[model samples]
Target: MSEVPAYLREGYITPDELFRKIPKPSEERLRARPVAVPECPQEIPCAPCREICPTNAISMPTPNDLPVVDYEKCIGCSLCVQICPGLAFFMVHYVGDKARITMPHELLPLPERGEEVVLLNRIGEPVGKGKVLTVVPREKTKGDTPIIIVEVPIELAWDVRAIKVVRE
Candidate 1:
């Protein structure tokens, strides 16, 4: 079996615990529509996103702080997925009438391109059906990264952040 990281094995690390420790936006601000390009919340040691940016849109002056991404210049190449150890990077394209989102999908029985799948929201709730546009397997990716790009309705773009293929 793969060994668990020291932090996780020691019960000293958890996604929720880390999020809770970070400052959050106000309730009123949370209700407003999020910007196309979201800001990073913590000063964590991560620079892969910056280095992976083909357009040089992301900048990280320090290793511990979150990198800044310039959305206007970003090309949505999904290169960050290959570099981020936390798998925290994603690409959102809202200009094609429909919204195209590319995210890192690490799971078994990977879906094929053009397959119809159920899109899920940030809370892991089913929202709608989305068509897979591309499935970049680990072999094609820089490492063990599998990039899944899906296209969904423009209105549901922001709501649908992930996908689960329906079993036949």
Candidate 2:
């Protein structure tokens, strides 16, 4: 394949993009609860994340533009994460000691709540272990992709995006 244009490269948004967009919530704000981090970097025309946001946290006037999010308004509900066809949204919650990170999970033999699993990084490299907090199916994902919430160390939470479960 030919070299991907810089603009097209943006389509492959990653956790790093989400990290950059994450607003620094004050200790007081953090106390209030969670917020969302959108990693959608594509210049393509897509706005499901914006339209599906119940709180109007994500907004996009034109399909060609990237969605804008109101950090304070975002509830970290992970609805955008599940509704995004590009699988570009991630909900992050920094709590007392661990971070509640939710990402889209489409694999079969889904992980169960309270189950232990091997955590993987952005590139799918095993990092550590985490406990499944919840497994949201398509029934509740706006008829789109399902989602999973995991509890891990705040440090690893930002890097870990995928998990491994022994199906055998």
Candidate 3:
């Protein structure tokens, strides 16, 4: 097994973990239902998600308000996930008859490339199985979070939004 990175071993809290604790936007407030996007609650000054959006899909317009994503134009490339300082971005793709979710994972002893893992939904519920498709470890990403791409059944794609490695 690979050694866990010092950050993970030192008990540091990652942005993804922190963001997951925030309540998701209520369905009534959303114009587009079913598509999950980060609705930042805090008055943080970070706007990487807005600046990094290739399609200008995410808009901050101002610094203090939450960033808004235009899902219609958003490509779900996960560029926001790679740039957000808060690690608050995630991508869900219901394509080719299967649902695929991409999130920021910074744990050490990272899952082996192509390993199978159990997928968890936004509510942290185990909904189905998924296979690791990519592990992005880049310098710009603070190298703390690894971008995990998990593939699940098409029917459960949207429902299975997060993943937890199945420990032996």
Candidate 4:
């Protein structure tokens, strides 16, 4: 068997490797729950999530260390989602039939509820189509960062992060 490649097309680790490296707390429980998942794999010196967390759920041992979520302490407030400068913070809610993914929306013409959009992966590949379940504008955000909630298939929850909303 060959070892995992040093880098993929996106110049980062593979999805399987990333999942193995990152700790998921939501899976430990059975009930539907919301959890914060940071896709930051680099050792960059940033700590906005730790500084802005009202519950002190995110821990940063050093400046360069990426944010680690203490799922027990996280209240699913999505403050980190808005405060994350790199737009790497996302919250996922695993519901009965769908998964709600909340992501930072800095682009113009924000998405709205009931709008259909193309779901894309980390590498800009269209995974599937999803429906916009909710949209939080800048004014309603904690850090003035607009966020949109899209409902996708339960299985695509982890694979789908961002959406391509059609604009006229």
lDDT (CA) per prediction: 0.65, 0.75, 0.64, 0.80
lDDT of 3 by residue, 9-111 (tens): 6444343543463433333322232233663555677787777678887777687767777666666667778766665676665556665667777666677
Scored by lDDT, the top model is: 4
Best by TM-score: 4
Off by over 4 Å in 1: 1-40
TM-score comparison, 1 vs 3, better candidate: 1
Deviation of model 1 at 36, angstroms: 9.3
Instruction: Report model 3's TM-score to 2 decimal places.
Output: 0.65
lDDT score, candidate 3? 0.64
Winner on TM-score between 2 and 3 is 2
Model 2 residue runs over 4 Å out of place are: 1-31
TM-score of each: 0.71, 0.83, 0.65, 0.86
lDDT by residue (tens digit), candidate 1, 75-163: 55567766676656666665446767777787766889989998987657898888999899889987577888888887785567568
Better of 2 and 4 by lDDT: 4
- What is the Cα-based lDDT of residue 10 in candidate 2? 47
Residue pairs with clashing backbones, model 2: none
